[model samples]
Target: MNWQELGKQVADYAPLLGGVLGGPSGAAFGTILASKFGTKETPNDIAAAIQADPNAALKLKEVESNNETKLQELYLKDKQNARLSHKDSRMPAALSIALTLFVVLVVYLLFFAPVPDASKDVLFMLLGVVVKEWSNAMQYWYGTTRSSSDKTKLIAARN
Candidate 1:
C-alpha cells in the first residue's frame, strides 16, 4: 500500500505522525515508524504492526512526541532552503507568473470563450491541474496554513 493509505490507517492512533507519513517526506517518516515499531522499512509492514499491536496508537503518539522537535527543525530547514533558492534563482518567480497567467486564461476560457462540449472536459481537466499548481505556487510564495499553524503554536508555547 502507499504511504497515504498507511497514513490513513495510522491516523486514528497518531494524527501527527500520520500526517507526516502522508506528506512529501513520507518515506523518511515511514522509516522512523518502522524503526520505532521494530518492523521492516515499508508502509505495509508498519501498518500491519500498528494493527497487530493493541497499544500501537499510544506507542505512535510517544514516537511522534519524541520526534516533534526534529519535525519542527525539518520544517524550518525546508522553508529556509526554499527562501535561499528563491534568492539565488528566478525560476520560481517565473514559474509562478506563468502559472498565474495560465489560471487567468483558463478562467477566461471557462467563462467567456465558446468552448465546445467535447473540448470542455479537457479544459476542465487542465483547469484542475492549473488550480493545484497555483495552490503550490501560492504556498511557496506566501507560505501555507501549516506554517501559520506552526507559528501560532510557537507563539503559544512562548507564552
Candidate 2:
C-alpha cells in the first residue's frame, strides 16, 4: 500500500484501539511505523510482519512505552524543580493570554459584536496558531525522537 493508503488504514482502525491509540495517536503510530520499518512501510506491510512475527507489534508498543516513561520522568522533574524553587511558573503565559483573547473574540463575535467576515477570518487564523502550539508543547510522547545532534544539545544543556 501507498503512504496515503497506510494513513487511511491507521485512521480507520486506530479509533477502534481506543484510549491513546484511539485519540491523537496518529503521531505515535507514525513514529513507530517510520522508525521500526521505514517511511515507505504501509499498513499491509505492518500487518504481514506482525502475522509473520507476533513480536512486531509488541516491539512497537515497547518503543511507545519507553518514550512515555522518558517524557513522564522529564516532565515530573520540571515540575519538581519548579516546586523546589518555590515559584509558580506559567511557562506558557503569553500563549495563555493569546488563547484568552481568542476565546473572547470568538464569544464576542458570535454573540454581541457581529464582526465583519475579514476580521473573523483573522481571529480564526490566530486561534489556529494557539491550537497548533498547544499540541506541539505536549507532543513528546508521540513526536519524533531526538536525533544524535539534538541528543548532544540536550546533554549540553544539562551541564
Candidate 3:
C-alpha cells in the first residue's frame, strides 16, 4: 500500500482498536450509555445492560473483525520485508567469503611453500591479505560455536 493510504488507515483505525481492546469501559462507554439512558450508571452496570442488548453485541463484533484484519496486514508487511533483505544479501556474502579463502591459500603457498625472494613483494601482499582475513574471520565467529560455551564457563569461573 502507498504511504498516504497506509497512514490514513492507521489514523482512522487506531482509536477504534484501542477502544475495543480497552473494552466498553471508562469514559467512552459512560458517555455512550449516559447519553442513551439519561442517567448516571457505572461502567460495569452499562456493560451488563449491553450484554442483554443484541444491537450492541453486533456492533462490537464488527469492530473486532476490522481490528483482526489490520493486525494481519501489519504482520504480512513485516514478513515480506525480512524475505527481501535476506534475498538481496545472500550472493554478495558468499562471494566475499570465497575471495577471502582464495587469498589465504595463495599467501600460504608464497611464504611457507618452497618459493624464492624474487616474489617477496607478492608474498608479503598475499600474506598481509591472509592475516587480515584470518583475524576478521576469527573475530566474526568468536564465542559463536559450541566450544565457546565451555570457554565462557571457564572464563566465568576464573572471574
Model 2 steric clash total: 0
Candidate 3's displacement at residue 3, Å, is: 22
Predicted candidate 1, C-alpha RMSD: 8.1
Q: What's the lDDT of the predicted structure labeled candidate 1?
A: 0.82
What's model 2's overall lDDT? Answer: 0.51
Model 3, 5-38: lDDT tens digits are 3223323434443333233222433444434534
Better of 1 and 2 by lDDT: 1
TM-scores of the candidates are 0.47, 0.27, 0.27
**Which 10 consecutive positions of candidate 2 have the poorest summed lDDT?**
14-23
**1 against 3, candidate with superior TM-score:** 1
Instruction: Name the runs in model 2 displaced over 4 angstroms.
Output: 1-18, 38-41, 69-159
Model 3 per-residue lDDT at 132:
77
Alpha-carbon RMSD of each model: 8.1, 12.7, 18.3
The clash count for each model shown is 0, 0, 0
The lDDT per prediction is: 0.82, 0.51, 0.51
Candidate 3 regions exceeding 4 Å error are 1-88, 91-96, 111-113, 143-159
Candidate 2 lDDT, 30-71, residue by residue in tens: 456556654434456664554455465565555456566543
Best by TM-score: 1
